[model samples]
Target chain A: MIDVLYFAWLRERIGAPKEAVESQAATVADLVEELKSHSEAHALAFSDMTSVRVAVDQELTDMSAPIKGAREVAFFPPMTGG
Target chain B: MGVRVQSAPFDMGAEVQAFTKAATGAGAIVTFSGVVRDEGGTLASMEIEHYPGMTEKALEAIRQDAMARWSLTDALVIHRFGPLKPGEQIMMVATASRHRADAFQAAEFLMDYLKSRAPFWKKERGADGASWVAAKDADEDALKRW
Candidate 1:
């Protein structure tokens, strides 16, 4: 089980902050592809790849990042903090 | 180095005082505070959401990076989550070094990294509605200079 988290608008659009997903995806992209097929909300939130950012196990990384043993994954828009 | 992620409001003056007290033999100290700006009185409030565990880790990593790259005697970062009213301080970063250049540069670097690298996301609610603040292209470009 992997804890998938959504933040900001992603959270609002997806209608939850976090959820548990049981998947065998190899990479973050694979996980995203799996998530995108989950529902319309998932499809809409993950629609524009350019606007979305991903972090595996709380470390900022790219879409190709491996999530083999990762416990958590987060999807969100680019950060606006300063 | 120290990092704090909280929902409570913080006093910049007291924070600086405490940081200065802990920083010994520092020739320069610089601090930057970010406030919620309600442009044209439209913004009602800003809701800051952050990944609880990752927020601290990211802040600490950035603080450590500054400490490693500079001659900083000490460094501190404080970021707040939850709803904040206009004019309220959102977060602050402080750096102490043996020279003004290091202090100044580190402070700016911290601010730049905190802008895009951190996990905090902001949603601004104005008179009409609310929207998530998008990351500016300039913010990403600014990181290349460092």
Candidate 2:
């Protein structure tokens, strides 16, 4: 199981911060597609890929990056922290 | 080395004192603080929202990236969430290095990355009501500089 995290408005819309999921996704984009199919809240939270960013194992990454053997994946909006 | 996400206002003097006190071989410490601003008194207050777990992790990642790219000895990132009034401290970053250049560059890089890469969303509350701040294209362009 891979742990998935959501942040900011994505968390507010999805109603949770983190979860564990079983996935057959090979890349971040594929995993996102699987998540989008899970529920309407998930779909709404991930509606625009351009507005979202992904990280694998705590490093910023592109959606096409592979997710094989990854322990954690996080999704968040453009960062406003500084 | 400290990463904090709190709603309470932070004291820059006290924080800098504490950070410098722990310094050993570090020769320079560069610090940056961001504050809520109102241009021409257009904005009244800002409400910042963040995802608890994911927000922390994202900041940590940014911190690590800064460390890896620069010859910095240590770093600290403090960001505030919740409702904040104008002139309130929004965020602060401190970086230490053996020389001034590394410390300065790392600190600025951290701020740029934090502004464009982190997952906190801001909503400005004004007399007209509340509205979500759109992600600025300039912020995206700023990240490319590093």
Give stretches of model 2 more than 4 Å off: A1-6, A9-47, A55-59, A65-74
Considering the two chains of model 2, state its CAPRI-style docking category: medium
lDDT of 1 by residue, B1-146 (tens): 59999999999999999999888999899999999997989899999999999999999999899899889999999999999999999999999988889999999999999999999999899888988898999999999999
Worst 10 residues of 1 chain B by lDDT: B125-134
Error of 2 at A59 (Å): 5.0
Chain B TM-score, candidates in order: 0.98, 0.96
lDDT of 2 by residue, A1-82 (tens): 9999887667778899889999999999999999999999999988888888888987778999999999999887776665
> Candidate 1's residue-wise lDDT over A23-59, tens digit each?
9999999999999999999999999999999999999
Tens-place lDDT per residue, model 2, B49-121, is: 8766656887888899999999988899999999998889999999999999999999988888888777677
Clashing pairs in 2: A79-B118
In order, what DockQ does each candidate have? 0.91, 0.49
Q: What share of the true interface contacts does each candidate keep?
A: 0.90, 0.71
TM-score of every candidate relative to the true structure = 0.98, 0.77
Candidate that would win on DockQ = 1
